[model samples]
Target chain A: MGFDWAVIHDNLPFLMRGLWNSVQLAAITVVLSFPLGCIVALGRISRRRWLRYPATMLVHALRSNPLILIVFWFFFLVPILTGRPVGDFASVLAAFVVFFSAYFAEIVRSGIQSVRRGQLEAALSTGLTYAQAMRFIVLPQALRSMTPSLATECVIVFQGTTIAYVVGMREFLHTTFLVTERTMRPVELYLFAALVYFVVCLAGSIFARRLEGKAGIPR
Target chain B: MSDPLVSIRNLGLRYGTFRALEDVSADFSRGTCIVICGPSGSGKSSLLRCINRLEEFQDGDVVFDGASLRACRDLPRLRSEIGMVFQHFELYPHLSVLDNVTLAPRIAKGKPRQEAEETARRLLDRVGIGDQAGKFPGELSGGQQQRAAIARALALEPKLMLFDEPTSALDPEMIAEVLRVMRDLARNGMTMLVVTHEMAFAREVADEIVFMDKGRIVERAETARFFSAPTAPRAREFLDRILHRL
Candidate 1:
């Protein structure tokens, strides 16, 4: 099949708009999931059973199910159960938040646990409360170690944004699909979409490595 | 005398049926230093940690400044009055030596920034690392890191200080620098509980010496008497072993 530069040129603006939407979705999901994941991670590692058990169950449950199924649950099942229609964008965002937070929580838990036990003991012995110790001492160090992993997760989340197309969210892939339908140029359009994903993810991985180097934490 | 700054009454601890400490009790009078020395796994470190509630004990209680640790509602407040330095130094790798020293005072004690910084500087100077304040823990030598850890512990102006083999992680030449700083602290009348294998430090600085074995304190006496004429056979054997090693 011959590539059509003119067709892509004609649809460039529309495709760019879809890319913006995808970026926004990924950004919001990532930003919101970070604090939520930290809380969940703290709960997962808490000494209290009330916090630990629920957090453990939630992480496992969300992680076990496929991301597409979670998107479907929010898009279709929520409205049916609540008897109120949820916006397509909101439902998709909610699903992303819920689904990605489970993974993020595990990252955060590992990050926090990676901090030496001596760090916690030092903070505590200095008369800092547990929360204060976490905020000032543990979290800063933990989060630094977590940067590379978290960057990788962001790339994964950005790729996962393509899945939102199934729920009719007009993200990059969805926009590309619409263009291909009208123009009948499936191969070229899909190739272009793949190129965009490759570039963005490659940039993300390089940024992650630079960040790990800057942190200078001994392996 | 003055109700002792800290009193440990029959402290007991266990780890899944392996007793780490049993009936370990002692009183730390104000401005006095006590040295606890024993072979590995003798519960000396565990006994020191229990004073600050770093390790939880199942039986008995520690009374600090007349407040029972078990009944004290504000543990952080109680802890703020005490300082602890670790064998590994435990300096926050992410923070500068200055920030590490100032963190507890600023965040935990709610000291004003100016005041905390001043106190931190004074402490860093006192520990003989005034020039190293801007350096991260990774940038400092082992002895320098230990001194910074001491400064960090002292920033809160604690009534008591606990040292858990603070010089054990240092090189032979580096150990003397840390010991000198600790010796000054002892001379200045800081109430200290030290767990170490440093027999010379125990002899010169400790007001009293405690010897432990198999999770129990086997001997307690004035530092001179304990070194010159230990009452317990275990303590005598330990002293002989350590002295010969040195």
Candidate 2:
């Protein structure tokens, strides 16, 4: 009851396409969410209650809910709100960005706070406005310190992409599941999918750990 | 003859019901150096921070260079004329010494990079770390880093300078190097407020010495008089303990 190499062999191109879609989703999510996360982080760390409270609430709300609920929330809500049918991939991408940003905001806030308080004092005393100091002195330091953590978070987002398969978005895992349906080789297909995820995440974590050392920031 | 450069009046501050500073007041004149020295947890550093608006005081106000600091709408503009050097040498570790010095002037004042870099090099040279300008703060020794910090502050061409325990975080051997730069600044007529334990440097460089205890100025006198004969018993005890430890 073992082998069906032929099913995978025949579907390699299709599977690779799915893998590319997964990567593309992850990449676009990272690029969009990181900067959005930074803005939300600033609000989270802000002195103004107007900014802090809403940002805090958003972070808590998004983080507390499971990603699947978030996926469904946008998947259904977006089309109704826009008065049209938004596709699954776009809907999932929206959910992914929203979900990942909350985590990234936390990372950014921690990174900004990790900078010695005296550094900001020095910048302020130099007559730099808070915005300018944040732009030049504080952020450069914070970005350097938070690089490893940001990379690690991106890996999680990549792994989290598999959940999109539930919505039938045809990502790597979804594509593998399709092949399994055609071949009646559930064990082989699922095992191959797990191996692929393990390999990608393993490489990503290794890269992150090396970055933590080079960044000289003790985790 | 003219008004004092900085006049801090009835300044009061608290930290959640604890009185950190109570009705503290002082006047710093132009072209003079005042060294504030006291025991740890005393109000020396807090008072310095208040002048630059780093710490918000609960009561009273500071008139800096003829304007009331509390009412000053453009704080960045007000701050630009005041320089601060921290004990830890907060030289912006990610930036080179030259970039650290040039950053504020270029960004805040709209000074061109060429102009800012020129001023930075000259100040760094004056601080005696000119050759080390290309290195990051992490790459510099404590002495070199402190000097670079001084250069960074000086680049603003501030009307007043604040040094909060400038040598307190340095190694014993590194202390003299930073103190020497401070000495040079004082002699060259940079209006400064320095909080330090180095009584000898204070004696030589400070026009006046302000001794604080438990958030109040216990005594303010000519540097020579303060060291030889302090009016306040608390100040006398502090000087005795500090000088003996040194």
Model 2, stretches more than 4 Å misplaced? A217-219
Q: What is the C-alpha DockQ of each candidate?
A: 0.67, 0.62
Residue pairs with backbone atoms closer than 3 Å in model 1 (clashes):
none
Candidate 2 structure quality by residue, lDDT tens digits, A1-219:
658767777888999999999999999999999999999999999999999999999999999999989998998899998899989989999999999999999999999999989889999999999999899989988999999999899899999999898899989999998888887888877887788899999999999999998985321
Instruction: Give the clash total for candidate 1.
Output: 0
Task: Report the Cα lDDT for residue A44, model 2.
Answer: 99
What is the TM-score of each predicted model, taking all chains together? 0.97, 0.97
Candidate 2 local lDDT, B149-240, one digit each (tens): 98888999999999999998889999999999988998889999999888889888999999999999989999889989999999989889
Each prediction's whole-model lDDT (CA): 0.92, 0.91
Predicted candidate 1 versus true structure: per-residue lDDT over B119-189, tens digit per residue: 89988998899999898889899999999999999998899999999988899999999999999999999
Candidate 2 chain B minimal-lDDT segment of 10 residues:
B88-97
What interface-residue Cα RMSD does candidate 1 give after superposition? 1.8
